[model samples]
Structures are given as C-alpha cells and as structure tokens.
Target: MPFAVYVLGLAVFAQGTSEFMLSGLVSGIAEDLQVSIPAAGLLTSAFAVGMVVGAPLMALFSRTWPRRRALLIFLTVFVAAHVVGALTPGYEVLLATRIVGALANAGFWAVALVAAVSMVEPAARARATSVVVGGVTVACVVGVPAGALLGEHLGWRSAFWAVALVSVPALLAIVTSVPDDRPRVTAPTGASVAGTGTPTVRAELRSLTGRRVLLTLLTMALVQGATFGAFSYLEPLATRVTGLGAGWVPALLALFGVGSLVGVTVSGRVADARRSAFVLAGMVSLMVGWIALALGAVSPAAVVALVFVQGMLAFGTGSAMISQVFHLAPGAPTLGGSFAAAAFNIGAAAGPWLGGLTIDAGLGFRSPVWVSAVLMGLALIVAGVIRLVRSPQFTKATVA
Candidate 1:
C-alpha cells in the first residue's frame, strides 16, 4: 500500500524491459554487429547467466549496507549498464554490457522483493509482493513490445537508449520515495531489516539448501521451464500454426500479459492462507492450458484462448511461490527470495533451449506446447509428491 512499493515496481518495469527486450531486437543486433544470429542470441544467454549468479552475490556483498543505499547502487548500476549497452561499439563489448545489465537487473529484483516485504506487516507481505511482481507482467505487455517497435524504426541501439531514458525517472523516484534502512532488528512484531542482526549470508545460504527446500526449488524450476518452453516460441506458433498475421503477435503477448496480471492479483488475496493449494492448483491449470495449446494449435481461437489461460495459470502461482520461500526460511528471507529467482532463470534458460531442441528435431512448432504440458505435469507431480512424502519432514525441518 505504500508509495515506495509502487516505486520499486517502477524500477522493476525498467529492469524487465531490459531483460526481455533483447528477444525482440536480436535480429537487428545480429545484422548491425555483423555477427551470426546465434551469436546475438547469446547476448540473451549472457544476461540469464548474470541473473543466475547476481542475486546471491548482491545479497552477500550488500549485507552491510542500508537497504535504500543498496537499492540506489543497484539502480544506478543498472542505468549505467543500459547506457553502455546503448553505446557499445562492438559485438564483444555489447555482450559484456548485457551481462552487466543483467547483473544489475538481478540485484535489483532480489532487493526489491525484500524492500517491498520489509515495508509491510507479516500477513500483508504476499499482497505487497503481488504489487511488485506485477511490474514484470506489465513490462511484458508494454515495455518489450515498445522496445521492439523502437528497434524496428530507430535501430536496436535506440531500444537500449529508450530503456536507459525511462530508467532515469524510476531512479529518481527511489531517491525521494524509499527511506534509508533502519538498524537491523528481530522485533517481536517480526519486523526485518537489512544488515548485522539479520542472518549472516553463509547461514542464509546453508539454510535454503536443505532437502525440502531443494525439492521446492526443483518444482519452481520445472514449472517455469515448462511454461517458457512453450511461451518462448509463442510468436512463431501464432503466425505459423494459428495462421495469424505477424501483427497479431503483439496482441497475443498483450493478452497473455493481462491474464498474468489477473492471475498474480487474484493469487495474492489467498497466498497467505492457502499457499500449497494455490501453487498446486496453478500448476494443474497450467498443464491443462498447455495441453489445450498442443492439441488445438490449428484453431486460432483455441491457440489464443489457451495462451491467455496459460499466462494466467503460469504467473498465478508466483506470489504464493515467493511467499512460501520466506516462510521456509523466515530469518533469511532475502536469501530465500533469491532461491526462487535463481530457480526461475535456470528454468528460463533451459526451457527455450529445450524447446529449440524439440523444434530442431523436426517435431515442429507445436512440439513446444507438448514440452510445456509435460513440464507442468511434472511440476504438478512434484508438488503432489512433496505433499505426500515431505509434509512431516518439512514440518520438522522448517528453519528456525
């Protein structure tokens, strides 16, 4: 409910734009740099790799700083990375800039969740988180497409410049909106803060790697991998399989974004009381949506409808998933948060790679949907098994 929470959301919009914009601009970048298309695609891969490593590393190094200061540092660095990305002269330099931008992007994501939750009461954390996570859905709907359009008319560097330009205002918002972190505390009210009394970075890392936690992380990875496997190739599926014109790709993406926004918003309302059930139902619904896409891609209406459902079902699980991490390691909430983030990118990187392999095998575009369905099914099964097998152990092992 605080204005600062929305400010952080604004920051995420800028970060998410940078994260996904490369997908749309890859071809133009390849041509401009005189590099192979695959090499340009590696820029996206570099960003993912940075994100996978950056969150925990940021948590480790920034543990001693005020949260507000840390956030400013992250945002400033992110803004600079985009500037470098916009101005870099060669392919190799651009690749490095992508990595740096992703590092800053990942760093901001980890801290922003902590920042949002820290501003709210325990019971309200999930709802607060939805407000922050909504930025990504909104970005998917708005930023990436706009960046793509800019790239088409003004060249790829202009898209990077556009992101950098938009980010400056968000950066300024944080300066006035977010307060400096208070001294660390473990108050009876369950107020958490940055630094010192907060669990040490090592302990936080150790606590989240337990058997139950690892299983949960795996479930997160599977769910995301499955979804991205299909969703990554959505434009092609829309144009090639559904027989839609190229212009419809943006519309399809926007519809999916709207569905995801609804999913996260609705899920936030129940996450605290029904976290497990929420995630399980989401995975099940996602599986059904993917299956529909696979079996019905030839029907344009079916493809469009199923994608909307898939977007809703897939993102519908996130608020609960994220809140569950904090529950699992209450003392090390930020690190726990990072666990979910890392799992997400790992799955994100793997999903498209797997989907690509499926396509290369001549399984065709629809095959990605099959991949999505299977992954979601596995995630559902994993959730089921964890419920059946790990309940007692999880109850006993929840980090104190």
Candidate 2:
C-alpha cells in the first residue's frame, strides 16, 4: 500500500475511536452529565442518525471537488466536532457535538474511500481500500477499548479529549501526505480495461439502483443489524449470563476486536484473490453459526470463543461486500461506499432498539443472539440468491 493509504488509515482510526468510544462510557457519561442512562444512550443513536443523514448528502454535494481536498475538509470538520465534544458542558451540548462529529465522520469515510482508490492501480484497488478500512478494524480492537479505559480512569470527557488529540496528528499527516489531484477518467483499452466511464453523478446514482446493488446493500444492512443488535448489549450479557466481573468485559471485547482485525485483514485478501460474492456468502454463513453457538453455549470459554468468531466472520465479509459495491457501481464508488456505510449505521441503530425490546419483554439476554442469527441467516440466503441470479446459467465447463 502507498504511504498515503496509511495516512488515511490514521484518520479512519481516529474517527472510528471517536464514534464508538461513547458506547463504552455510557455509564460514566450518564453520571457525569446528570442524565439518565437511556438518555446518555442517545449519544450513540444521534451519531448513527447523523451518519445515515450525512452520507448521501455529503457525497452528492462534494461530487465535483477533488477527492483529497474533500477528505481534508471533512477531516477538519471531524476534528472541530471532536473539540466541541470534548469541551461541551451539558448533555444537550454534548449531544449536539456528537451530531456534528457524526456528520464529519460520515463525510470523511465517503471522501477518503475515493481518495484511497484513486491513488492505487486497478489491480491493487481492493487491497488499498482494505488497508484504509483496516483502520476501523484496528479501532475496534484497540482504540475503543483504550478510550473506554481512559474514560474509566480519567472521566468520560477525557476520552473525547484523547480523540481530539489524535485528530491533530491525523489531520497534519493527511494534509502533508495525500495528493491533491482530481480524479480523471481514462478511456478503456487493451492495457487499461478498468478505466471505463465518466458518468455524471445523476447517471451514477441511476446505475447504482440496480437489483444486484440493492440486494448487496440489503445484505449489508441485515448483517450489520443482526450483529449490533446482539453485540451492543454484550457487556450486560457477560455479567448476567456468565457471571463475569465488570472488569473482564472490556478484555473480552478486546478479544472480539482481535478477531475483527484478523477478519478484515484476511477478508481483504480473499476479496482480491477470489470472487467477492462467493466470499460474502461463506462469511455470512459462518456468522450465523457463530451467533448460534454464542447463544446456546453455556460455558464461558465457549461464549468467548464464539464471540471472537462472530467478530471475525462479521467483519471479514465487510471487505468483500464493499468491493462488490464498488464493482457493481463503478461509476460512483464513493456514493456507493457511503450508502454502504449508511446502511451499516442504519443497522447499528436498529439492532440495539430491537435487542432492548427483546430484553424488556423478559426474553433472556440470549434471545437477541438468536434473533441476530435468524437475521444473518436471511442475509446469507439473500447473498446466495443474488449470486445465483447474477449467474443463472451454469456452464458445463465450470460446474457439473
């Protein structure tokens, strides 16, 4: 990967940490701001809503700017929002700050993706994108946990301050390292088959709405919803079900993050070397099994193992689906990637709500795991159907 991609990864790492750190500090924030836990929870929901609202809006508005400039602008916005988040005094102000931060987060990822892809050769695009997104995986493994620990020891506001501190270096690295050239379209020829069309933004949106692309987005949404629906409440589950102490929950989460890091790294290679659709199908299937095991297994060791596996399968497939979106909608990879990101947040928002309902209704903590398994199964079926539809005729040369 180019050095520029690593800079983008740092930006992504900072963004991801800022975005997810709130989850681990909900109790601390509630106590510090004199708000109810549920209200503190709105911090997460507000961010998700902002991403959903901002993804397409930013993509549409920044269509004409050079991708690098767009990235820098959004990263600046992100850093400013984190500053606001760090300095806010009241719950309402903090909530508003998160909203701004979420918008910047959504816009940054959308633009950074285009910038990353534009920097690499066609054959290297998937790997380059993977390296950029690996920042998110790393955040899951390290940043979130570290922020949570900081918040636990120093106060919740300290976590936001740490995020802000990281943003300065990330911004400097991006501005100094990333090239500022606009994306140029080259005509496709024998040596350059990947450079195809220079479609207008409107035409790009139209093409992206095809059935295959829609199915891919749905698959992404379902898998994300299922995973978050169960995963968000994992700490409570660990305490209530396994009788583990509160201190160990973060360690377990770190394990899950380790699995995610492994998954994202491996999945990138799989997407590059194999058919993305096939890889997506297999990963979703693996996720279903992992969720099932996590729900039904009584042993704590088994639960931890299954959670790690769930993380691995859930994130491993992410690269494949992202690559598929770019391939299916080559005319507007940024918009498509943004839409996928939005779908992910949409699922993130929905999953917790549904899981809360299940818990409120006296369903066991494991019920959400079962629910997630069913949803993942549905996603797997959708993936299989999409693959079959895309290739209805199985030639004797390859099959049977």
Candidate 3:
C-alpha cells in the first residue's frame, strides 16, 4: 500500500470517530441541550441523511477539481463543523453542525475512495479499499471507545473537540502527501468513458446508469441496511435479550470492531481475484450469522460470538463489493463514489429506522436480526442474479 493511502486512512479514522462516537454522548448531549434522548439520537440520523444527500452533490461539484484539493477542502469543512458542534449552545445548532460535518465527511469519503484506487494497480483495488475501510474499523475499535470515555469524564463537548483536534493532523498530512490528479481514463477502452480528462456531469451521470453499476449499488444498500439494522440494536440485545450487564456493551462493541478489522484485512488480499465467490460466500455467511443471532439471542456466549462474526462478514463483504463498483461503473469515479457513499448511508439511516420501527411495533429485539437476515437474503439473490447475468460485455467492461 502507498503511504498516501495510509494517510487517507488516518483522515478516515478521524472522520469515522465522529460518526460513531455520538452513541456514547447521546445522554450528555440530551441533558445539556435540554432535549430528549430520542432527539439527541436524531443527530445521528441527520448525519446519515447528510451523507446520503451530500455525497452525490459534493462529488458532482468537486468532480473537476484535483483529488487532493477536494480532500483538503472537505477536511477543512469537517474540522470547522466539529469546532462549531463543540461550541453550540442549543440542540438545533448542534443538529445543524452534525449535518454540516456529515456533508463534509461524505464528500471526503467519496473523493478519498476514488483517490485511493487511482493510486494503485487495478488488481489492488480491494486491498486499497480495505486500507481505507480499515480506518473505520479502527475508529470503531479505538476512536469511538476513547471518544466515549472522553465524554464520560470530561463532558460530551470534549469529544467534539477531540475529533477536531485529531482531524487537524489528517488534514495536514493529506496536504503534504497526496499528489495532484493526473490524466487517466477511468473507463474501459472503446467505451463512452466519462471524465477522460475533464469530465462533464452529464457524461458522468450517463456512465452511472450501466446495469452492473446499478446492481452493485443496490446490493451495497441492502447489505449495509442489514448490517446496520442489527448493529444499531446490539446494545439492547446484549443487555435485555442476552442477559448481559450494561457494562458488557462496550466489550461487545470492541469485539465487533476487532472482527471487522480482521475481516477487511483478510478479504482485501483475495476479493478482487475471486470477486464473485467472495461476495457469494460473504452474503451467505452473513445471512446465517444474522439468523443465528436471532435464534441464539438467549445465550450470552452465542450472541457475543455472533456479533464478532457478523461484524467481520458485514465489513469484509462490503469492502470487496465496493471495489467492484468503481471498476463496474467505468469512467465516473467521482459519481460512482457518490453513489456508493449514498447507497451505504441510505442503508445506515434506514437500518436503524427500520429496526426502531420493528421494536416499536412490538416485534421483539430479535425481529431486527431477522430483518437483517432477510435483507442479506435479498442481497444474496441480487448477487446471484448479477453473477448469472455476467456476459462478455461485463467481463470486457471490468477488465481494467
């Protein structure tokens, strides 16, 4: 991996920390801002929404700019948003800050993925993506826990301040390490590859409509929805269903993160080569994992083990599939990144919302796990269809 990819991962670590750290600070934010806990939780939803909306727009607007410049711009705005979030006096202001920060985060993610892949050989797309996604895995393992601990001791605002502080170095490193974008036709030869040198929005949008690209996005959304749907409620499942004490939640989360780190690392090595098999196997494993959680919720040990496995399967599968999106889309790197980001965030937002709905409908916590399984089943069916439809055109288009 390039040193620049590592630096991009560092930037992702800081941004991702802010994304997941909100769970721990919800109570503090609710109490301090005179809002209900549910309202405080909306802050997370707002970020998700921002990501879904901002990604495509940001990518579209920044398409013509150099990748490094776009990255720096996004990080700067992200840092500013964190600073404002820390200093906000009211819930609404804080909410606005979260949205702003999310927009920046989404933009950074959109551009960074394109940048990282462009820096490597076609064969290394999955490995490069894993390096980037690994940052989020690390954030889950270390940054979030540390942020929550920081909030617990110093106050919730401290976590925001810490995110901003950590982001500064990432911004600086990106400025120094990342190179200017060079002319490279991202599309396959003889195709109507958009953005050969200076890509037009119309051309980019056209490229995104390819069947392979659309299918990839749909699969991404479904898989993420299933993953987050179950993940959002893991704490409740652990405490209420599994009979674990409240203190066990953090450990469970860490275990999940560790599993994610392992999964992404391992999958990165071979996903690109055995792309179809990797996806098929991962989706199947994930479906089984979710069903196991639903059936085994009563056993603390089983639930604990399943959480780690599910985390691994979810992230590892996502890393592999995401690499395919760029190659599959052909010629619209920024737009493809935008769509990927939007698809993932749509799932991120929808998963928890759907999970909450199931809980509110008096379907036990296990219902969400079942929901996860169903989503994975849908994804598996889609992946199967995608595999079945692979023609010579498909092979030709994706042949780097």
Candidate 4:
C-alpha cells in the first residue's frame, strides 16, 4: 500500500472524530447552548442525514473533477466547518455547521474509497481500503474519549477546537502526498468487463438501479443498523447489567476499539481472497455476540469481552461489504461506494432512534441488544436470499 493511503486515513480520522465526538458532547453542548438534551442529540442525526443526502449528489457532482482536487476541496470544507462550529454563538448556527461538515465528510468518504482501491492492485484493494478505514478505528479509540475529556476540562467548544486544529495536518498531507492524475480503472474481481475512466453520472445512476446493487445496499444498511442500534446504548447496558463504574466505560470503549482494529486487519487479509466467507463469518460472530449480551446479568468481565467481540464483528466486514458493492457495479465503483456510505449513514441515523424507543418502552437496557439481534437475524436471512437469487445457476434458470 502507498503512503498516500495513510494520508487518506488521516483525513478519515479527522472527520470520523468530528462525527462521533457529538456522542460524548451531548451533555456539555446541551448545558452550554441551553437546549434540551434531546435537541442537542439532533446534532448527531443532522450529520448522518447530511451523509445520506450528500453521497449520491457529491458523487454526481464530482464526476469530472480530478479525484485529488475533489478530496482536497472536501477536506477544506470539513475543516472550515469545524472552525465555524467552534465559533458559533448558538445551537442553531452550530447545527447548521454540523450539517455542512457532514456533507463534506460524505464527499471525502465517497471519493476516498475509490481513490484507495484504485491506487492498489486488484487483489490488494480490500487491504488498502481497510487501512484507510482504520483511521475510523483510531478515532473511536482515542479521538472520542479525548474530546470528551477536553470538553470536561475546557468546555464543549474546546472539543471542536481540537477537531479543527487536528484536521490541518490531514489537509496538508493530502495536498502533498496525493497524486494529481486520475486512477487507472480496472475491472473489479467479479465485475463484467466495461469501459471506464470512471462512469458518467447517467451510467452511475443506472448501475445503482440494478437489482444486485440495490439488494447488496440493503444488506449493508441492515447490518449497519443492527450494529449501531445496539451499540448506541452500550453505556447504559454496561451500567445496568454489568455493574461497571463510569471510569471503566472508557476502558471498555478502548477495548472495543482495539478489537475493531483487529477485526478490520483480519478482513484486510481475507477480504480479497474470501470476501463472501469473511462477511458471512462476521455476520455470524455479530449474532453470537449480540445474543450473549442479551442473555443478561453476565459478570462485568464477560460484558467487557462481549463488547470487544461485538466491536470486532461490527467492523470486520466493512471492507468486504464495500468490496461487494464495488463488484456489483464496477461500471460506477465510485458511485457504488457512495451508496454504501449513504446506506451506512442512513442506518447509523435510524438504528439508535429505534433502539432508544425500545429502552423508553420500559424494556430495559438489554432490550436494544435483543431487538438488534432479531433485526440482524433478518438481515442475515436477506443476505442469504440475495446470494441464492443472484447465483449464476439461478440467473441462468430464470433466463431459460
């Protein structure tokens, strides 16, 4: 993998830190901005909504722009939004900045995925993608906690200040390290041969409309929803069921982050050669992990271990999922990648909202895990169905 992959990863770390820090800042932001906690919570939703909306639009808009130029533009937007967010006087302006930031974030993700894969050999694409995505793991492990700590000591605005300051290096790195020319397009592992320099917007839209592409996108959405729906409530689950101290929460999160690193690294190794099996295995691991959490009243150590295992499973299939998305519509791999980002963000927005409802319904902290498990099981079934129906023999029989 090229050093530019690390640069892209740095960019991902910057935006991802911005994206997740809101979870840790809700209380601080609510207090400082004089908004209801629920209203402050909307900041997270606004970001996710922007990601979903930005993906396809940005993919279409950036079609003619050189990939490096598009990336630099998006990073500039991301960093500038953080500055605006840091200086905002009220919740409304801050919310607006958050949305703008997320739009830039979505664009970066869409372009970055294509750039990463295109920079690598066909067989190494998944591994390259994993390295870029690893930035997200680092953000989760260190960035969110550090932001929370900063907020506690220096106030919520300080956290945004930190994000804005940290983003500078990534922007500079991209300007220096990323190549100016467009990537050479090669056929995806399973994609039918097609002309490419990257598809036109019309071709991109057509590829997105195909049955295989749409189904795979749905699979991506459900799996992501199940993961976040349960994970968003982890703090409460740990406190109520596992009896861990608030101090240990960070440790738990850190352990989960470590497992995420492990999982994605493993995926990097096998995703190219065994993408389908890697994904299936991760799905099964996720189911088992969620089930264990739902079984309830486990020892604190056991709960910690389960969260680590869950994080591993939650992140393990990322490269494989995106790889499949690319293969399903290689004519527009960039747009296909954008769709995956959109689906994941849409799920990130919806999952916790649904999980929150279950908790509010008096089902207790463990309910989200059980609810998420059932939803994940449904996703697993759909994946199987899609696989069966899209198999060569099935397609041939249908044609006959």
The models' CA-based lDDT, in order, is 0.82, 0.78, 0.88, 0.83
Alpha-carbon RMSD to native, per candidate: 3.3, 4.1, 3.5, 2.9
Candidate 2 lDDT over 64-157, as tens digits, reads: 6777788878888877777787777788888998888898888888887777777887666677677777888788888998998899899888
Q: Model 3 has how many clashing residue pairs?
A: 0
Tens-digit lDDT track for model 3 on 295-329?
Answer: 99999889888989999999999988888788787
lDDT of 4 at 190: 35
Can you rank all candidates by TM-score, best first? 4, 3, 1, 2
Model 4 clash pairs are none
Q: Write out the backbone clash pairs for model 3.
A: none
| Tens digit per residue, CA lDDT, model 1, 76-103 | 8888887887888799899888888888
TM-score of each: 0.93, 0.91, 0.94, 0.95
Model 4 stretches with alpha carbons more than 4 Å out: 182-196
Clashes of 4: 0
Off by over 4 Å in 3: 182-198, 391-400
- What's the lDDT for residue 364 in model 4? 89
lDDT per residue for candidate 4 within 1-400, as digits (tens), equals 8988889988898788889988889999999889999999999989989999998788767756778999999989988898898888899999999999988999999999888887888898888878878888888899989999999899989999898888888888888888786634333333334544555566667788888778778878878888889878888888777788788888888888888888788888888998888888888878877888888535787787788888888887765787778877777866876888898887787788889899899998888888778877887897898888888999999899
- List ranges where model 1 is wrong by over 4 Å: 182-196, 393-400
